[model samples]
Target: MSGSLRKGLYVLSFGGIAALLVLVLWRRELYLPLSLLMIGLVMLPFFIRFERRRLRAEELLLVAMLGAIAAVSRVPFAALPSVQPVSFVVIMAALVFGAETGFLVGSIAAVASNLMLGQGPWTPWQMFSWGMIGFTAGLLRHTRFMASRWGRAAFGFGWGFLFGWIMNLWSLLGFYDRLSWPAFASVYAASFYFDLAHALSNVFFLTLFSGIWLNILGRVKQKYGLLENGRAG
Candidate 1:
């Protein structure tokens, strides 16, 4: 296929996957497998492009290092279900790097760690949630919101809850096939305290350490001159 035609096919495939994801929002079982496939599909083009650039090898190295940090950070917090610094690390990675880097790091962190943690249907959702969080941070890095300390704290606070909420979907889907607001609310309520801990931990960490992390990452990026064209795309 011509390059343009090949690109069009990818676009169509992504769109189709997106539309199906929407359609299966209430169908728990179908949602898991489809969402899993969707993540893989999204990753396909990203790695394809990675092969095109020698520069990307350096970028990939940085992403791997950051991703390893994110994944390993989860180990220390095993005593607690929700409170972890992985989110903070991923967010800072995005803030310093860019969306693509954030996305890759977040996604890889999930998949790679799951290999050690033991993968299951929930793996994809974990990947998607963390990946999106990182992507959003990177996307907003230049905006005034990300530029302010208060804003970064707010972002951290929000993503902490956001992470838990997405994980709740796993319980909702895997446990209950027939969805209802009451059941959903029950699941959410059960997870509330854990989520709050995660959120507060994020707020505290961002309040105290975001500046330091950003400065360190900034030095790394500048020393390496990474992601020169904004995002990888």
Candidate 2:
């Protein structure tokens, strides 16, 4: 991505997120619309970038396959709270494919899995959170920091907490009228363990499986030249 465009996305994402939080705090009744707005603001750019490309069927198939695998990976772990391999899969995809593909895979995984798991107001939030996870991983894929397994593990661990915190905002909407510091603290406090499980799970998956996934996906990318020109940023 061009430096200017990347800067624009930074501003758009951060500014939009801040605006959404303020709006949600001001009027909880508009949560649905606000969420939709967020989804558009955060996702539209990447989708537009994708649409401009002349993609082949095989490239499209790879994307679908990755998304399907990500969504399906959540099923067996339904019994565990927030301890799924969805994030792991998304991260691996992003690392191999690039940012735009990563975002697509992440968003698709969320919506597809929710079809079986049940969708609610939280769906958009999951899409946004996971999408951003892939987006960030892809953006940093070339960096020396992310090239290391430990660094990637650290990234997953941080996102584990970050994803939980983002989801907590949706829960806080229910207590809008009674919103207070204590209430906020209580909600997060209650989620601490669950979030820790998520974070640790990311670390575990990244530590044990990242290298293998990277090698496998990397070979496929090289062999077929999928997403060659359009994946960066």
Candidate 3:
């Protein structure tokens, strides 16, 4: 990507996040959907960049397969509060696949899973939240922090709650009339244990399965000659 494009994307991604916070804080309820749509539209350029770089048929299929695994990975954890392997898997894909692939895998997984679990207004939020996690990981893959195992675990832990809190906003907007500190705190408090479960589970999977998955996917990438980015390795 061009330097200008990269900078613009960063602005759009985190700028949209900042806007989301503003909407909640100021009770600009009507603008929430529009903000989300704008964010999605801004991200289209990144996807377009990937396509322009010549994403091949097999590579797209690879992303779809990974997304399918991520979507179905939640089934076994249905009995749990928030423990699931979806985020862990998505992070791994980003670690090996770069930002664009990670974004698609994360977004597609949310949509695919929700289609089976039942969709609602929250679907887009789920997609955006999870997609951001993958994008952030991919963005930082070349850094020393992401190169370390403990760092990856820490990131997974943080993203688990981030994902939950972002998802909580959808519920907040869908059910509550206005955003207040008490309401926000109450919502977060109620979901605290579930978020912790998710965080711990993500850390566990990152610590245990990251190496295994990375090794396997590394082999696959080498065999298939996928993802030409230097950061992916």
Index of the highest-lDDT prediction? 2
The best candidate by TM-score is 2
Per-residue lDDT of 1-233 in model 1, one digit per residue for the tens? 34696588669768976786676674655876766777677666656654454565777788899999999988878788878887888889988878767887888888888877789988888888888888899889999999988898899888888888988876776678787999988999998898888888888888899999999989988888887653362
Clash count, one per candidate? 0, 0, 0
Worst 10 residues of 2 by lDDT: 224-233
lDDT of each: 0.80, 0.88, 0.82
Residue 62, candidate 3: how far off, in angstroms? Answer: 0.6
Model 2, span 195-223: residue lDDT tens: 99999999999999999999999999899
Q: What is the lDDT of candidate 2?
A: 0.88
* lDDT for model 1: 0.80
